[model samples]
Target chain A: MKKVEAVLIDLSGTLHIENTATPNAVEALKRLRASRVKIKFVTNTTKESKTVLYQRLKKLGFDISQEEIFTSLSAANDLIKKDQLKPMLIVDDAALEDFSDVSKFDGKPDSVVVGLAPEKFNRPVLNEALRLLLSGGKLVAIHQGRYYKTSSGLSLGPGPFVKLLEYAAGVEAVTVGKPNVEFFKAALEDLGVADPTTAFMIGDDVRDDIDGAQRLGLKGCLVQTGKYRSGDETKISPPPDLVLGDFSNAVDQILSHIGQS
Target chain B: MLVRVLSISIGSTLLRGTCNHISSFTVKRLKSQASNMDGVKGLLIDISGVLKDGDVVIDGSVAAIKKLQSANFPFRLVTNETLKPRKTILSTLSMLGYNIDEKILFSPVPATVEILKRENLRPHLLVHPRMIPEFEGVDFNDPNCVVMADAYEHFTFENMNACFRKLMAMENPVFISLGIGKYYMDDDGMALDVGGFAKCLEYATGVSPRVVGKPSRDYFLAAVNDMNLKCDQVVMIGDDVLHDVGGAQAAGLKGALVRTGKFTKRDENHPTVKPDLIVNNLAHAVELLFGTSPS
Candidate 1:
C-alpha cells in the first residue's frame, strides 16, 4: 500500500445517507482532519444548489467549508463560463440559484444544459432540448448518473435522458461531472497535488467514484453504505484497492495504510 | 384552411432555414383539389387528444375524417393509449360515428404483446383491467419479468418494489414499459400515468425499460412500415408534442402538432419539438393535408 497524500471523499453514500449522516461519520471526519491529511468532498447531486447543499451539510454537523466542496453543478458552471454559452437550462428548479451568475435563457440558445429536473423531463421540454441540439446547439450534461436514491425510493436520474437526446439528435453531450477525469483533475489541482496516484477516492458507487478514480491513477476505496447493491465490487474490473464498511472504516484504513507506508 | 409543407423534399437544411419565415407567414387555403398535389404518401394521426377526449368527440373532428376519406388519401390512426384493447377502442370509435378500419388503427398494446411472445416472457402485468384481454394467451403466473403501462389503480408500493428486486437480483429480468407518460387527460382531470413509477423502477434496478409506446422509434417505425412507405414520405399529426411529433420527426417523418386536446399555446412554437406544421385542430390538419375542408 502507498502513503495517501490527499483524500477525495464522496458525499451521499460515504458521509451521509440522504438527509442524515452515516453512523459516526461526523466524528470520523473530525479524526481525519486531525491527521493533517488534506481532504476534499465531491458530489453528483443535481437536485439542489451548492449554497442549499452546504446549509444541509452544516445542519448535519459536518465541519466542511465552501472551498472544500466540489460539486457537479460547480464544475458545470465552469464549463459554461469557459465556452461563454447562452444555454437553455433543463435542470431542477431548486438548483437554478447556483447558476444565477451564468444563466442566459432566451428561447434561442447556443447550448442546452441538462440535469435532473423531474417535472421538466416531460415531452415538450425534452423535445425542445432535442430540437435545439439538432439545430447546432451544444448539449452539456452535468452528470450522467443512471439513477439515485431519494426519500421515497430510487428515482430516475439524468443519464437516461442524456442518452435519449444523444440517440435522437445523433450528437453526444459533453459530460462535465464525476467519472470525467477533468473533473477529478480540477479538484486535485485545487489541492496542489500534482501526482494523482497519491490521492484516494472513497465512495459507495462502484462505477462513478471508485472505478472512475482508479482509472485516473487514484487509489479507489469502495464503501458499503448508501445505494450499495450486493455484488457491486464484482461489477467493476480491476476492483477497488480497499473495501470498507463505511466512511468510518474507510478513514481507519487510510490512516493505517499511510502509517505503514 | 391549412397548408402541409412538402417537408421531405425540402430536406432539414431548408426546414431549419425557413422555419421562422414559415411560422410568421399564414398558409393560404386552396380552393380546388388540383392544388393539393404534394408528394406526401400517407398520414399518421393520433386519436385520443386530436379526435376525442374520453367518449365525447371534439367539434369538427368528424368533418376532418370525412375530408380525409373524400380526398382518397391513405391515413392511419396511431395512439399510445394502453388502457383498453384494440377491439374495444375500434368499437368505441365506431359508436362515436368514426369510420375507422381495424387494420389502420395502431396502438402500443398489440406491439407489446408481440414482443412478449417473441421473447417467451412471463410478466407481472401492471396495466388497466380492460387491457388484460390483449394478452390473454401470454403467461403471467409466477412472473420472471415486469410489464408496466398506464395501470392507474394497479400501481402499488409493494408491487413496484417486488418488480425492482426482480430486476436487481442478477437474474436480469426484463422491464417493459408500454407508455412513459407523466399524466393523461381522462374523464375526470389529469391522472398519473405509468412513466413516473416506471422511471423509479428503472432508477432502482439500473435497467433502462423498453418503451413500447409513442416517442419510441419502434412504435413510429411500426406504423410507417405497415403503410409500406419511407419515413420521409409520411406525416404524423397529433396533439402531444413529444410522443407524437417529436417521435415521428426522430423516425425521419414530417410531424404536425394540432392545437386540440392537450395542446397548449406554448406547444405551437416550442423550441425543440417544433412540428413542420401547426394547424387549429383535426379539421385544420385535414385541410392542410388535402386541399379543402369537409363540405
Candidate 2:
C-alpha cells in the first residue's frame, strides 16, 4: 500500500516467464516491499487486457492489482486524448481496455491509428485504408518493427501493416509507443522520477527497451531471459549499457547502482 | 488492318478518360498470325450511342449484327448497361429489331457482384431509388456494410450514418456503381454519381471504396465471357477511358472509346494507354470488323 522512492521490476521476461510469473518473483517483491521501493511492472504486450495481464501475473504468484500493470494497449485512451484526435480508425482488437468509451467513426476516420488488429485485414479494411490515404487521410503507425517474438513463436506485430500504409500513402506517421520518446517520457514522468541519470530501464527487447532507454540517457539493461534470440542483440541501433541474464539480476544491480540496495 | 475499338470515335479513336481530345498513338503490331487468317478476331461494339435511341433500337445496327454473323466471325457486345440483365437486354434488343441473342450483351452489375463475392464484403448500394423494385429479391441482410443505389438526397450523411449502428467495429463496405459520372433525370442537369457518396464515406472513415463497375476487370470479363469466348478474343467498347478502355485493358482485353461519351478524341494518345483502332462511329466499326479488319 505504500508508494516507495523507486520501483524496480520487469513485466514479462523477468517477473514472469512467457505469461506466467517467475519463481520467487513474489518474494523478490516482498523484499522490495521491505525496502519500500515502488515495484512497477510495465509491458508492451498490447494484445491482452489489463485484467487478463494481472491475472497472468497473479497466477504466477505475484499479488498485483490492475492499476500496477502498464501495457501499451492501456495507453490508447491517453494517446487519443494527447493527439486531440477523434473520428479515429483503430487497427486494433475490437475490444480494448481504455478504448471502451471512444466513439467509432461513422464510416471513415479522420486519422488511422494502427496498433494491433490481427483479425480484420480483409479487402474492405485494407482498401478502405488505401482509399483514404489516396484521398489524403492521415495515419499514425505505432512502430515499424515487423515481427516480435513470444514464448510460443514469432508473431506478426502491428509494424508490418503500419509500414504498408506508409508506403501506400507516401507519408510518414507520428509514432506513439516504445522506441519512441513519448512513451518513455510519459512512463518516467508518471513514476515521478526527476533525474534520468539515476534511472534504469529493464526490458527484454533490445531495440525497444534498451535502445529506447539509451536514446533517452537512461541506463538500459537487456534481459537475456525473455525475447532474446540469436543475432537479435546485433540489431539494436545503439547497444545497451548492460546485458543481464534476468530481471532479478538487473533490478538487484539497479537498486545497488542507485545506492538504494 | 481493321481493328475496332469501343468508345473511340471513328475519326480519331482514343481512350475515353480525363484527356478527352484528339491525339495519336504509335501502334505496335504483334507477329502477323494472318498466314491462315483462320484465327479468332475480336470485335468491340457499344450499345447506347451506337445502337439505340433510348429504348428504341436502330434497324441498321441489327443488320450489322447479321452481317458480322454471316462473315463466320464472332463479335462481343461491350456496353455499360447497368439497368438490366443480359437476357432482358437481348430480348429488348430483339423486340426492337436487333438480331442479337443473350450471348452478345454484358452487364457489369451481376458480374461485379460475383467478383466481389470472393472478397466477402458487405456492400452499400447507391443505385437509383426507383430501381429498388427490381432488387426486391436482393439480400440486404448479408454483409450490409454499405449500399447506395440512385440517391436523390436520400443517400445523405445522416441516412448513411445510421448504418454506423451495425457496422461499428467493422470497416465500411465498398460502394459499387455502374459508373461514376454526372447523372441526369427529367430536367435536373447534374447530380453526383454514386462515386461522390462513396467519397464522403472515404473521407469520414479514412476508408475509400472499391469500385466494382465499369473499369472493374470482373465486370469486363463477365461481359466478354457471356459470349463464351477466350478473353483474348473479346474487345471492349465504351465512351469512357477509365470505364471502357482502361477497364478492358485491365481485364486483358483491348478497348476503344467513342468521341461521343464524356471523353473526346484527344484521349487516344494518353501516354499510359491507347486503343487498338479508332473509327468514326459504330457503323464504320462494323465495316472494319466484318470486312478486312486486321487483328
lDDT of 1 by residue, B132-193 (tens): 88887898866777888876665544455556656665376788899777654445444456
Clashes of 1: 1
Off by over 4 Å in 2: A1-10, A22-24, A29-39, A82-84, A87-95, A104-108, A122-124, A142-145, A259-261, B1-295
Q: Compose the digit string of candidate 1's lDDT tens values, residues A1-261.
A: 556789999887788877899989999999899888889988888878878778888999999998788889999999999998998888888999889988855556888888878667654566566667767899999988766666665555677667656655668889998888888888899899889998999998888898889989999999998877778899899998889899999999888877888
Using lDDT as the measure, the top candidate is 1
- Residue-level lDDT of model 2, residues A1-261, one tens digit each, is 112245524476667766655555577666555655554566665656677777777787776777776556656556676766553555455335556665554555666766666554332354456556656777766544444455644444565556545554556777666777666656767777765555667777777777876787767778776556656567776677788777766666665654533
TM-score, candidate 2, is 0.48
Query: What number of backbone clashes does candidate 2 have, counting pairs of residues 3 or more apart or in separate chains?
Result: 44
Docking quality tier of candidate 2? incorrect
Q: What TM-score does chain B get in every candidate?
A: 0.76, 0.67
Give the least accurate 10-residue stretch of model 2 chain A, judged by summed lDDT.
A1-10
Tens digits of per-residue lDDT, candidate 2, B1-295, equal 2444433445343322212232333111211212212333666676775566567654346666777788766666756555555667777777777777554555555555555555665554555454454443345656655654435545432344443223433544444555543333323333334444444344333344555557667666666665667667666655566667777777887665554445555676776777654443454345445444422
In model 2, how large is the Cα lDDT of residue A212? 75
Docking class of 1: incorrect
